[model samples]
Target: MEFNTKPDVVVIGELNVDIILNQIDAFPEIGKEILAQGMNITLGSSSAIFASNLCTLGSGVAFIGKIGKDSFASVVLESLNSKSVDTSHVIQSETVNTGATIVLNYDQDRAMVTYPGAMEDLRIEDIDFGFLSTARHLHFSSIFLQPGICEHLPELFSKAKSLGLTTSLDPQWDPAEKWEVDLSNLLPALDIFLPNKAEFLLLTGTSSMEEGIAMIKEIAPNLTLVIKDGSNGAYGWNYGKLVHQPAFLNTDVIDCIGAGDSFNAGFIHEFLKGSLLKKCLKTGALTGAVSTTRPGGTGAFDSVEGVSKIAAENFKMTL
Candidate 1:
């Protein structure tokens, strides 16, 4: 698929090597250990999969992120290149090792332990404003995990907005058992804010989704907020109307690792095609559901034709 000469979206975040161990009955105890049934290594990370899916769906994508000069980074770059995501803006660092995650799958649930490594070293100074100015949209992820990016988000989004580029952000779960941030200040800079129900609640300090949405609206009056509810589906508010889209049911569950990233890709894909907000939410849910049936986040799909088929069969929407 030939994309437009100018890039449609640029994804800025972290890339990591994911080492997945399959079929474990339970997480290892402090002093006890258990062996996994199978293991696999793959290129993983929110930005990586987001870019991959966008490229697969025939979007012009450029990824700006940090990785170490190790073989892990090599594998990630190779994978991205194979998927046609432009990697010219990916910076190579020597101080930190490329990030990696150890995933243990038990039953249908999984546990992950991640070392930020080079991901933490991604600084705003490494960004090239000129490259970002060329994109129609900017998708940012894992901000809270990368302190540097989180601190400099205002400047980054300000530059993008100044250039008339719409900005979207996905804040990953911060496992620190506490949520800290001034959403009131951050949300105004973002055109789209995508967060899972749990993250939304944590960020807003609200007990109900309704309250969370209200709080977000208060902060970012002009922004669109998307709240992803795992199996139940997704909810979005645009033009003061609430839209709910159910998740596409999948028969088999593989790994839920990159589901949200895939959802982001799907949402952006349909939104770019001028789909309605509700339809875009459904597309995101559909892609996320389909992603759970696959083992890896950046796994192959039918791209436009395949997603269209899924939409017709599962989502009951015409592409």
Candidate 2:
């Protein structure tokens, strides 16, 4: 694909491939092994899923991340290219291997172990401000998975803001359980901050959603805090008032992989189009439901028409 105009959004974060194993008989023990009835390998990473789905939703998307020169790298590139997400800014490293995640899925929940290879090598110095200045919005994800760039996130978001770009961050799970991010320095620079229910609690050091929201109000008063709460749907802070958007329930959920990232895609897509907060939240919930209808994250979002069809047929909503 060629771009004659600036991209609508530029995604800067980690990239990897997911090796998913589903329908496992039982959990694995130290001395025993388990069997999985289904398996698949696809593009895996919050940033990749968000970029691909957002591009499919009619936004011009560009990716800037690091990967290795290997088969998994090929899979990552091809997957993003298939979605027409510009990957020209993706750096290919000869030294490090591409990252990968081994996922053992059971119904709606799953456990994962990741090997952060090239993803860990991406740093603030690798970012090209010239290319970043071309986009109207900037989104970064999986802060814990990329230690090299983690501490520099504030600088990154600050620079993007200085260049007149709206910014969002989806700090995915902190595998170390020690959420070391300095939100005080970071949150002030972000236009939107996306975190799941548990992540929000942990990040805020609070036990309840009320406490978390209160902390955010004190810290980043102007920030748009979007919390993804599983089947209960999502919550967005509107003028300091918490508003709820219920999920579009799917009785036959294939899996819950990449649902949050899809939600971010939908929300950000509408947000860039200058839609209202309620519309963004609703579209996010609807897209999240669409993700579960298919096998993987990008499966249900094959095309714009297909996504609309899924919305109308499965969720009784016309997009």
Candidate 3:
């Protein structure tokens, strides 16, 4: 059960490439076309971004996800490898095309259109328990995008817990708008549940943060709930108390892509290191702010030293 040489974290979730379009003059109308002044293609997916950035932050990270054996898959592999994250466990499908997201970036916010592709085909049966046993922690994301494994999330988390691995989940936005996961069955098995404010509101079916917190506590009293509130900050419910970490504001942000995933990465990085909840939230906020300074999620996370420099210079905080 001891994984001395294994990765610090194993990320099991969606994978894809992002085609980011930035600096658009106006939102596109039904018949009218719009011009985007900048564009960049990079690895995309909450899980992959978290794994890559976490590895960049000195965690031994590995990834398990499905991607097509195509050019875009190459981008995903190369991007993860560039971060020194283990990709040997990633699955490649010959028939299915790799997933991709076209992001329309508008200053501080963006709209995304995703083609789920192989990501939707990643079922729980494809997961390797032997490989999972090699990591100390398990982090899953984008539940709404992966239907094959979505329904079995509770079972998956339960199994991971049985195997003695700490677990976390980030239920990203549900494109279907149904918000259909069974949280009552899933939260008790999960150690951490990270959801942005809007996602928490939708998933919990509550109008305000206090209501959502009360509801979640009723479902899983011991669960650590972290609400990522953009601009305002992040809120954490741990040990029966609420804690808030303000956002490390970045006025000259290039884009907000992958900022939340980066926040998860930073938080998990500190969590696995036994840091205090407040320190973890601060690290999360700092990393999230650092992510906005660059083009994409992984751009500003080339190295810990590089990130530290940016944190000091841009955000006035030393990592």
Task: Please list the C-alpha lDDT of all candidates, in the order they appear.
Answer: 0.83, 0.93, 0.91
lDDT per residue, candidate 2, 198-247, as tens digits? Answer: 99999888899998888888879999999999999999995698899999
TM-score of each: 0.90, 0.93, 0.91
Model 2 weakest lDDT span, ten residues long: 1-10
Candidate 1, residues 1-319: lDDT per residue as tens digits?
A: 3334678999999889888899886778999888898998888788889889888888889988999999899888998888888888889997889999998878867788999898888889998888788889999998766886788888888889999888999998886856788787788889888998898898899899888877766777788888888888888986677888888776666767688888889899888888878878977888888778656786635476875675677557664
User: What TM-score does model 3 achieve against the real structure?
Assistant: 0.91
Native RMSD of candidate 1 (Å): 2.8
- Which predicted model would earn the best lDDT? 2
| Model 1, global lDDT | 0.83
Backbone clashes (count) for model 1: 0
Scored against the true structure, residue 204 in model 3 reaches a CA lDDT of 88
Q: After superposition, which runs of candidate 2 have C-alpha atoms over 4 Å from their true positions?
A: 21-39, 104-112
**Cα shift from native, residue 34, model 2 (Å):** 9.5
Number of the top candidate by TM-score?
A: 2
Ranking by lDDT: 2, 3, 1
Compose the digit string of candidate 3's lDDT tens values, residues 74-104: 9999888888888888999988999999989
